[model samples]
Target: MIQQSLVLTGKQKLAWLENEVRDLKDDELLICTIAGAISIGAELPQYNETDVTDCNPVYPRETGYESYGQIIRMGKEVTGFAEGDRVLAFYGHKNLGVVKANKTVKVPDDVEYRYALLNTLSCDAAKGVLKLQPQRDDKVLVTGAGTIGLLTVHFLKNYMNVKHIDVLEPNDKRRELAHELGASHTYSKKEQISSTYYDYGLECSASKDAFHSVLNSMKHHGEVCILSDGNKDLFYLTEDFYEKELKIVASSDGWDYQKHSQWFFKETVKVPQLSKIFEAEITSDQLIHCFEELSESHNKPLKVLVRYL
Candidate 1:
């Protein structure tokens, strides 16, 4: 079967595109190798409008703003990514793209695909965790225990010296996973947030109410690192921002590495911080669920790495 990069104007139409890599380059390696496949998450929210203009309006830019699987294909040509390398791409959904070489990062062979996909999430975590560095024995609160939030737990506990890492998760199973993943404490968003000792707050959950929770529960002059992608228009965030004097930094893909032009025999590059945030690398043998499994997912570790087993 030939492989085609599937695109949908809306997510409900995704059922038709699922598993539909029907147009291929006919190269045995293209089918056999992991080159053509990519990873993705965050399906089009079903209830939301399909047009997705405002609220989720084109992020990076029109047409190119699509995240998840879109980036894998969008960055294919411009980024000098060499074909055949195991790339850790954040282009969303289960891998579907025609990406260029440089746009992708090389995944070490020992890393699992699930973990490699998890690595893309670490970009923001790297930023958040770095903020609390030299740890100061300061208590930390992470308001969301999903993949990214839980991943943050792994980073803070294993890598940093923070006095405590508290997690806020509504999902029971995910809460268990957070503890297993090394969270010092966990709470449901429904429960009242305690300002016992936390000096830093990382809001990975995009829940509208959680933003206020981040501010209300934080200690005086505490740092609030928001890693979600949403409009500040969700509510008036300015007053508390000014009143609490909180350093509320919006980290919705704000990182852009400026590199020197590549010249023969010389290259200047700013490496991504995947290893610091991702749980670990994954190999092709660990490929689990495919595109379909990820799209319709309700509760599953949608995190994955795409490669031929």
Candidate 2:
């Protein structure tokens, strides 16, 4: 079978290419995509061809990690999921794809497809929050107001019950949105932060300066979790690190998707603001033009959602 796939052939290039769909393995499930989201933090570098992580980055890279759909078929050996089960998987922008059954989590009947699409990112935020172990009285600081950063704020304030959470972001619109999503204070500049103020911090901006600002804002012996991809700007330990004796830890993917999804589905009802992150929507066919717009400097959406169905 031939399936259409969204691929990046080169820097700032996107194409809907055709690919052969091989037979599924015994433990795999075939999914018909409903919707997916562009991970701006991770994909922007690949789109711009400015990824600093690789001296000579490879081209024709498959882009996307947040997609969910209904299972159209299951391998003979697959268990615990039916043909029509709604599931979220790490499959990219392809409309049809196969994934291991263990890699997917069933979407609840009540959860909307848009909300289910955010399962991966929500779990990413939850992982960091759990690692930080924030308390109700503890003041928190989060860098960046992008999707991951904003989601980090949501988890810290709503789920973890952190009383005070400040955000660092330069964009006025994003800062305003951050305030609406429970950020107590928002700063456009690092100089505005008070020294030794926050008990815990999370770096989600993927900027070295933002990381430095996080370290500067921390109280003595403060702990911070770095959640940014950090491929765009490299992070370096600052003087505050040695002076204040801060502790820094980093979290990437979620520890348990199935377990986290069960809790996330029930708890998301309380966080209606999650919808704000995915305000921009486009059809799968418009992806090429969407990437062109995203390549321009001024194009910024909290998150761009692609509807396949």
For each candidate, give its TM-score against the true structure: 0.64, 0.96
Superposed by TM-score, candidate 2 places the C-alpha of residue 296 at a distance from the truth, in angstroms, of 0.9
RMSD of 2: 1.4
Task: Report the CA-based lDDT of candidate 2 relative to the real structure.
Answer: 0.87
What TM-score does candidate 1 get on C-alpha atoms? 0.64
Error of 2 at 177 (Å): 2.4
Model 2, span 1-309: residue lDDT tens: 678888888877788888788899999999999998888778887788777776587777888988889999899998899988889999899999789999999997789887787778878988988998999999999999999888888778777878799999999988988998889999999999998899999999989999999999999999999998878887889999999999999998986889888877886787777788886899998888887887785758888999998
For candidate 2, the per-residue lDDT at 276 reads 80
Per-residue C-alpha lDDT of model 1 across residues 1-309, encoded as one tens digit per residue? 333233444433332133444332222112123422231223333212332225453322211112222122222224343344455443332334443334445554544443344444555565666754628477888887755676577667655746588887787766777776667778876455674346888887676677777777777677877775443225347455677677776564413211211110021012223223232224433322243444456654423333333
Clash total of candidate 2: 0
Model 2 TM-score on a 0 to 1 scale:
0.96
Query: CA lDDT of each candidate?
Result: 0.49, 0.87
Best by TM-score: 2
Off by over 4 Å in 2: none
